[model samples]
Target chain A: MDTLEQDIKILIIEVLNLEDISGEDIASDMPLFGEGLGLDSIDALELGIAMKKTYGIELEAGDGRIREHFRNVLSLAALVRHQGKGSLTHTP
Target chain B: MISWDVPIVRWVQWPGIGAAELGFIEPLLRRRLSSLARGALHVANACAQGCPSATFVFASRHGELTRTVELLRSLAHDEELSPTLFSLSVLNAAAGIFSIARGDRAPATAIAAGVESFGYGLLEAHLRARKSPAKPLVYVYADAPAPDPIGPQSGDPQAVFALGLLIQGDASSRLHTAFRPGTMVGTPATLQANACLRALERGSADWTSDRHHWCWNLR
Candidate 1:
């Protein structure tokens, strides 16, 4: 997996406390919500907080496209790598 | 019916410590402790993991609220506390971590009954086991007194301790517990976890421990 994808997977496992799951088990295109990874809204909020702290990118409530952006590990990584470039303010 | 009388197959104690130190106690129990048992202990100590240890009923009087308070204090002072500690500060943090670690999908509850925290937690665990006859539930109770500036001036420093009980119902080790409400004084020494262990060791049907001075009878 690419750096971004790997990072996103780590973040999911870390934030969600997915005990038995490893990055290898999470398919790039598998849906993270509902039956796929079984993640819920609370997990999204947790991920949002982690992203803001780690990448300095804030996710606003009205960002309707968040569902699409956080669909899976691949999508989340793409979003981070793209928005992370100029929008990030916190440096590690 | 679940039995509480089974002789304790194994018991290990880790007093006044964190997850790392708590890990040290496992080796001693390894000869008799099941993989599930060890996993429960690990999960109990490391609350971030979701697999709940097969806990009967867990209790924490102060819980890790102390960490939350510390984190808030650090935030107020613009200080950066250790992220790891901050993450583990939640009240149910340890229990949650243990649950994840053990991969126990069974029902586990944590209680904060103040001076009665330990007794109440035990009662809950005992009741659950009685209701379900299959397996012994692990019950762990621990606490760390508040720190200085907000610390209890007269209370014992480093009083933290945890007790893990694998409770089952059977004739030979059949155990019974009774509670009586009352008041007392003097740092509530009987409320200490060690005191409770002593009571159990002696096969006392009635005894008291630490601050929550209420009396309990266990056979």
Candidate 2:
């Protein structure tokens, strides 16, 4: 679980070009958009691409909980783990 | 000859092609700017310090072609196009970013005119300024050579550079510029920044294209 959280943080930094930021800077439960990290909608879509490429997860628009799963690193880690059971789908 | 008196209030140009210090913008927003946009916004911000609201003319020969090419390559590979790159790949990306940064809603226009982008940009700025003589016009021209993917340019490679001009309605300003149709043979396209700088320093400068002659004289 800890490793998954750290991986997601690295992925965020790399994919978003978040210079001078590291996994240590991002708390697992902090919001990723409009508040804590202050990321915008474009960033959300970018992260969705990175996550899809890394974990083979496909986010569909019809899923209502997409926002919830993308709320923070903790939720993203959980989603990756849950989807790793071969349901390579996402709601992003 | 059609011309407008674009009296220069102040101007700034990049020392040369390099990183621009745009510390004024937030890191998040700043990170998104290409080097071209950074140099452009830096000089534009310098010339527009006191005047918060004005009409803007942003001209570029190859505006964000680097980003556009990358997006196209991604599409060719059947890869998901990066949303950020797709959004910022437009010709007016720099102008749009400038408006967003300043939160100034003044009308802005972006121009691209082959090798004569700088000259035509100034002409456009004059036309827009004519509509509202009371407001200052911020004219910014920025370009790097067309990226390699587009193929080599016919002329010498132009250095990555940006020039900003603050034009007011004062008629007594020493700078006088004019352009007219002319035929010139065997001259490489002149980068307007170098010509304008020479005109400012040595009292006059002239450049020619296949269709027009642009000259700046200081009186």
Candidate 3:
């Protein structure tokens, strides 16, 4: 669980071009959008795509809980962890 | 129209400006604006802050190369391109974003005319203004070199430049600018856009690019 959380943080930094930020800077439960990390919808979309490519996890746009799932590193880590047994959307 | 004159109202040039400095572009939409778009918007916002009726003219030699190059690479590798990058890669993406953000339905245009892009962009505004002489035009120009695999390896490759001019004809404070057809055949020592901007700066009243002759004077 800890390793998954750390990896997701690194992924977020890399995929979002947050050059000024480090993995230690983003708290696991802090909000990723609006206020906490100053991220926006486009970053969410880009992160969603990056998560799918990296973990083979398909986070559908239709998912009602999609916004909740992407709130922070913790939620995103749980998402990737449990999504391993779920169905995939894109082939990649 | 080579001898045409455009009265300039307010103008700004921001060289080496980046997206981080453009907080006026709202965090949500700002995230989507590419570096090129950000630079263009930087000048656009600076020149037309509260003027909701401002018509826009966005000019760029290479509009959004970083994202376009990435999308091309993804195609080469058969990788899935993200929807965000694909959407913002258009030539007039900045102008569109500005209009939507401002919720103003004024006319906006995007132009790319090779070596004569800036000169031609200015001409485009004059043509548009001729239709409605009372309407003011906000001309914005910005360009940063395309990256990697297909970018220039050296030699003054468009250094993240952006400029804006609030143009109005027959204004109290008017700077008359004229363009004459010059016989110079090859690329000038300076970039074409740089020639116009340098003229706006402390350079001189007369400037020459590869094939266009430009002159500006304040009346």
Candidate 4:
């Protein structure tokens, strides 16, 4: 598994409090919300906060397309790697 | 008259709380719930098992004191309070969780009345029920000693305890309370919750406090 995928998985667990599920159980291409991990909108806001604090990737609180970036571990890993500029404010 | 002897139809209590039992709370809320809130919600859920539409009154002598103290300390140090802590540090935060969880838009209250919190809180619930006699009320009292060095000497033990009373208003008479200006010095337990539950369990006629005598007629 890619290091970014692993990091995102760990972040999701730690941020959302999914004690019932382990990181490895979250498939790289599996959906993250709704039909996937069953997390809701509040979980999204919390994840956004954690993402900014951890990766310094500031997500716009109202970005509709950003939902696509958070669709799965594969998508999130790509988002994190794409923003590898280390610490950047991402406003979409 | 320190008046209020409403009928308590059901009750739920947690003698001691552990984090493992709270796995059911969402991770977002779990991290935010103070020990006080965690204990209170645990018993609230239990007491309100079948009554989601019930009103609620949460009583505590010191609700979220530790969180408030932390915020105060941060302000003193010229540090910004953590957004999550700032949001959840209110006295009513824990009590409001019941309303949120149950999706009940009905009235919910959080109250503190020194050592007489339980009595006064129950009184508040009684008054609330009077407004709409059809709805039942759930009264919750929870307390946990504050975090270190702030009031350790004055604080209660580290134990987190909570009890919930379900008031159905079925009985015409149940409890009657009278206020006294001077302290009567009841048992060592300062929490009104402990006193109230003990009186119920032991079938005592009355529970005495420093300022009031609560007469229970559980017949």
Task: Indicate which candidate wins on DockQ.
Answer: 2
Worst 10 residues of 1 chain B by lDDT: B27-36
The residue-by-residue lDDT of candidate 1 on B51-168, one tens digit each, is 2334457776777756667778878888545454455666566555554444556666878876567667877777777676555566777765666557742322265556666665
Any runs in candidate 4 off by more than 4 Å, and if so which?
A58-68, A85-92, B16-34, B66-87, B131-134, B152-157, B183-189, B205-219
CA shift of B173, model 2, Å: 3.2
Error of 2 at B128 (Å): 1.9
- Tens digit per residue, CA lDDT, model 3, A1-92: 38778778888877776755788888999899988998877777888888878787777668899988998989987887788543333222
**Per-model CA lDDT versus the true structure:** 0.58, 0.82, 0.74, 0.70
For model 4, how does the per-residue alpha-carbon lDDT over A9-81 read when each residue is reduced to its tens digit?
Answer: 8888876667657888899888888897777666766677677667766577587869898898888767777
Docking class of 2: medium
The list of candidate 1 runs beyond 4 A from truth reads A13-27, A35-38, A85-92, B1-57, B70-110, B120-140, B144-161, B164-191, B204-219
Question: What is the lDDT for B99 in model 1?
Answer: 49
Residues B1-219, candidate 4: write the lDDT tens digits. Answer: 555566777777876444425554666456557667878988887777777588888988777888888888879988645555667777789866656656677767899887677777877888887776667788888877766556732224357778888877774436544454546655444555665676667655555555666665454
User: Cα miss at B211, model 4 (Å)?
Assistant: 6.5
How does candidate 1 fare on TM-score? 0.54
Q: Candidate 4 has what TM-score?
A: 0.75
Q: Where in model 3 is the C-alpha error above 4 Å?
A: A1-3, A17-45, A58-76, A83-92, B16-21, B153-157, B180-182, B202-204
**What's every prediction's RMSD, in angstroms?**
8.6, 3.3, 4.9, 5.0
Provide DockQ values for all models, in the order shown.
0.05, 0.71, 0.31, 0.15
Candidates 2 and 4 compared: the better one by TM-score is 2
Q: Select the stronger candidate by lDDT from 2 and 3.
A: 2
State which candidate, 1 or 2, has the greater TM-score: 2
The predicted structure with the larger DockQ, 1 or 4, is 4
